[model samples]
Target: MNDESWALSPNTRKPLPQLIEDKIRQLIDSGHFKAGDRLPTEPELAQKMAVARSSLRTALQRLQLQGIVEVMRGRGWYVRSTSVSDRDESLVIDSRISDSDLMEVRIALEATAASLAALRADDGELDEIAKRAREHQGASTEDKEELLQTDEEFHAAVVKASHNELLEQLYRSLVPKLRGYRRNSYGSAELHNRSANDHNQVAWFLKRRDEGGARTAMTTHLLGLYNDLATQAGTAAGERAELNTFAWEDEPRWRDR
Candidate 1:
């Protein structure tokens, strides 16, 4: 594999570590490397990716935390699996685990992530989250694939900013299940843009280090998904009433245009 192929775009707004992370993930996804394949040493990888070792290490730590790759003592990093999560893809498809089930888990994990990120994220991390939110907000609604990818990146950046590896990993594990449902639901630009606005709200709070505000914003954002699922399943009225009993005192704007 050509190391120069991993060169990052100068125009990209993503942080250096994130850019490195994306490049490595892309290489793995494209089959340049596979599970159990050994990756180059730290120095080699940094040189190849044209990034500082600190940035490369940070990227690798995120990947390793998510179970994408494994590090061996006295040896080197190795690709663990190409799949985003180790969770069985069939579990999400078999209907044994409903999208609502995953949604509840996501709400809990992500709200906490946003709150912690607010307390801990550096300026660079905050900037990345804001950049992703804007990208998603302006994403073309007609292009389902592009919209989904942008949305994914925004959420991922938020979770990563939490600086809690375990929390980030747990959230990443839910991505595979969430993607299919989200793709089906993005039927209009309005919906996509609204979600993007929610992302911005979360980022805004994080930038100001307002933990409670960030948490509320994230919960509000996710409740949008809950609303859609409940409506589709004919449980909107009952389920939404039940959801409001949580810590978020404000009525959810699930139906707000």
Candidate 2:
């Protein structure tokens, strides 16, 4: 593999860690690092890329979150899989449930949580929610894992503030199932910024103890996310169709049987 082909060049507009991470992805795409291949040691990779060790580690962590790489305890980081479909399959629990189905349940629970939270949350709970929202907004784009974590924390706070044990328990169980979809939905900077703004609006309504306003804001945000996910899925399907048309000219093996 030619190191020059995957060289990391610092961009003024993007974080250094992000640049490094992008280069790593390019390496994977170019066959420099195949699935199950062990990544170079931290110091070696950092020196090779002419970047700080910390920056390289941060980049690796981002890839890990995306399921591109996996760190084996006391062993080292290795490429998990190059294909997004492979990674998605591993993250998803049930093949029967679609993204739309997940979103339907999430919207109902989140809206109810927001409404109840507005009615029940005290000043302290509102303060905690605000703090999480601020953290999410301040997070850098390269730190998407942290951003997602804070976003979950903010929602969890809202659920907790609702003071409904059954609702809280149900939401908690659904969270793990939604992790992959949530990450995909919030992948871009634009989406993240929009979500943060939506969260602020919900927080504002909660602080004012306006149950209706909070519920409406939450509902709108979740619905927007669902639409975005649907659009993305459609686009991806189109791309796959184009690729298959060109690459699979002959009928599939099973089709002839």
Candidate 3:
């Protein structure tokens, strides 16, 4: 028998392309795919997955966009990770960020917005928050997208209420991706309902302008997911917390645009 050192041992469970991408991400995240490491060619991957090269390519392209891998014209693809940064930028753009990274980002954004929202939101904004919350609650399973949209709208509205246009715009840009990652990473009905409940509290606090309550609610709401992601976040934040320290929030934005 010709033994291939790189081959994943055959398992009863077959992996789809999406699953393959996720597995590869876990490998990269765990240092199995180090920076400058050349991923095996498409045919090698196809053999390993017991699938076609095309599917592997599709997975690789998705990873490419996630900044998990970089493709070179002649040299082939290499793992793109260095010391992974866990701040706003890393969380904002990571298409396949683990559940823990999603939770961490949510804690920072949601808790901060909660207080700002309660303090600065106008009546119209408060009403909008109510309308979206009701809309989310009323949706049946057929309206998953709407439920998801309303969830984002409720939180983004809180960020907008902060009266800082930059924070509002940043939230606007990040929330869609945030929602998308959570859906992909968790995809649990219980988690979805939990997210809605957390959002409802934020909306309620917005209406009442209860700064302390909002902050506490947002922080508490994010805790479950944060705990869930904590094990995975060890790669970026726990032992690696020192490299994770980049003061982007303290850095000034040249916002003439």
Candidate 4:
């Protein structure tokens, strides 16, 4: 089809699901939307992409199930996975389950995660992990903001350590809401320090290419952090950042990449 013809006539080639999914993914990858940023409503997205609302919803549901996007009861979908926000944010597993039950699930999920990562992590991804850790190493105490940023970096790496897309996506969704809550109300450094050593040890293990060590270290690391945070705070305050406060970076990470 000619270019104008194609633009004027609805796309008749690709499946509607694939079309909407690709458009949404492009918007995300292009930095038109960002991690934690809410997407346009399903109707809006469908109109923007020229697809049926049902197809758009299906695409969003797929993204949500895959962990790249998250759906709140009335809030709509948000971008969840990214290199920066994932760590600074704390993890929040969805549940009616008790902390103990969640811990068991984490053990099974993260252990297998490390094993797969040991085999799958590419050199480039590993380098990214190391870079974030170094950012943590030099983070100044006076730089609470930087420290918070670095802390997120560190956890984001561990989530990355699993080398599984779903794991990264899941942790991304959970961590930010968790961390944002802590930052908003109590600002608990004592609670954060409690988990730093485990984070350090896990980072060291992954760097060493010790699969067994990585698996065990990460498992314990997450559980300990979970307990420490759980003791301090169990639920997000149900707040969101003011638009001016965490303004979308004018030049975001993705534009050049």
Candidate 5:
């Protein structure tokens, strides 16, 4: 390994362990290390990065959570292939869904959930939903992933509150896809705030026991997301076509456009 290239320079802003993890990911992506390649010994890597052994281990553990690397007993850390196929089964299924299609199904299911929740949700269920919404609203910029998780929890709470077992099962099955969408679109603080506001509106209607209002609120929120994603997809398609006219030729000719 090239110690000079891999070495981490002094930085005060971000945590040292996170920086180390980022550098390791960069190395893997840049082909400095390939799948199944064993990482350098902990002490060696720590010396190279000018960090403590404990810090290096901490970074490695973070990478392990991300599926970027794996630790072998009595051995060492090895690079894991960061391929789409390596993702969770549900996430792999999510990858196959178009944004528009997923949004359509989500809108249908969640609007119904909101309507039912307004009528069926008890005080306790409403309180749980409110708590989740509050947590999401209070989340900071550094808590983007946490916010996404909270967003799902809030939605799930609403679905559960509907008291429809089949509806809840269907919504649970779509969790992975919903998570993928939120993670992609909720990267910006502005988007996060917008989503929180939408959730608040839905919760408000449900709290008032206004089923029609709750359904409308949920529908409007999902429709807004669908429009945004559709526009983004159209723009990306146009840009890719303009940049490379032959880009489509690389794919299976039999595949649908």
Candidate 6:
């Protein structure tokens, strides 16, 4: 790719990372870059685009999150196979359960669980949640299975810390139902990073014994996942608009208390 092709006007509205992301996507879409092709090194891309390495990395991370490219440690970035084979079973889980339905129940259960965990979890339990969060964050994006495993463990640790056997039991029962949804939503590197960050926030609050903060953090985290899944499900425009605004945006009833 020519450096001139990457030149952006000072008046450009988008952030540098987003601009670079769009440029790279265009290149891939136009076949200038194809599956299995290696992208230029970070230094080369930064120089050619006249952007900082950080910005270039952000763009590449976004691409990786979109499954457009993947990174191999010690090697450069490579475009990944986005093609769906006829035998693809990525979404072959129980069709009776919709993501929104699952998320609705999760928000109710896990948010309360997070709050209870903040009040009840001992130092060791809190440390376990923190450890799981860091493990998920450090897990390589190339290993989707490991990444998802770490994520699940992190959530499981949080629920277990709540010391509520009923909540834990319900959550354990729901775990199998969540596997397909996890595979569907946790595809990109960016989403993985976001989840890790949210987990960190949840852990932070739990450690501080901040019940409200823990609950809010957990709710916000799950809401983000719910919104992502809803958007990807291709709802109508009006419904999409509604879905974008979460119910929590309204004033909390407890505010009057």
Best by TM-score: 1
Winner on lDDT between 3 and 5 is 5
* Candidate 5 runs further than 4 Å off: 1-95, 235-257
lDDT of 3: 0.61
Candidate 1, 1-257: lDDT as tens digits: 55468777675787677788888888999999999999989999888877778567657765765678766756899998887556223234444777777887788898889988998888988987898888888877786756766777778778878889778767876776676688789997678778988988998889899988898889888887877886786754644433552545652323212
TM-score of each: 0.64, 0.55, 0.49, 0.46, 0.55, 0.57
Largest lDDT belongs to which candidate?
1
Worst 10 residues of 4 by lDDT: 238-247
Supply the global lDDT for candidate 2: 0.74
Q: What alpha-carbon RMSD in Å does predicted model 6 have with respect to the real structure?
A: 13.7
lDDT for each candidate structure: 0.77, 0.74, 0.61, 0.56, 0.72, 0.73
Between which residue pairs do clashes occur in model 2?
none
- On residues 46-132, what C-alpha lDDT tens digit does candidate 5 reach at each position? 888888775576577556544567666568899976553552322334467676667767778888999999999999789878887
Q: Write model 6 residue lDDT over 26-88, tens digit each, in one string.
A: 677778777889988999888877888756765675555344676675798998744533112
Segments of candidate 6 deviating more than 4 angstroms: 1-95, 237-257
Better of 5 and 6 by lDDT: 6
What lDDT does model 6 reach? 0.73
- Report the candidate with higher TM-score, 1 versus 3: 1
- Model 4: residues >4 Å from true position, as ranges? 1-108, 142-144, 181-194, 233-257
Q: After superposition, how far is residue 128 of candidate 3 from its true place, in Å?
A: 0.8
Q: Which ranges in model 3 have alpha carbons more than 4 Å from their true place?
A: 1-99, 185-189, 229-257
lDDT winner between candidates 1 and 3: 1
Q: Which stretches of candidate 2 lie over 4 Å from their true place?
A: 1-95, 235-257
lDDT of 2 at 44: 81
Error of 4 at 144 (Å): 4.1
Against the true structure, candidate 1 has what lDDT? 0.77
Scanning candidate 5 in windows of ten residues, the lowest lDDT window is: 238-247
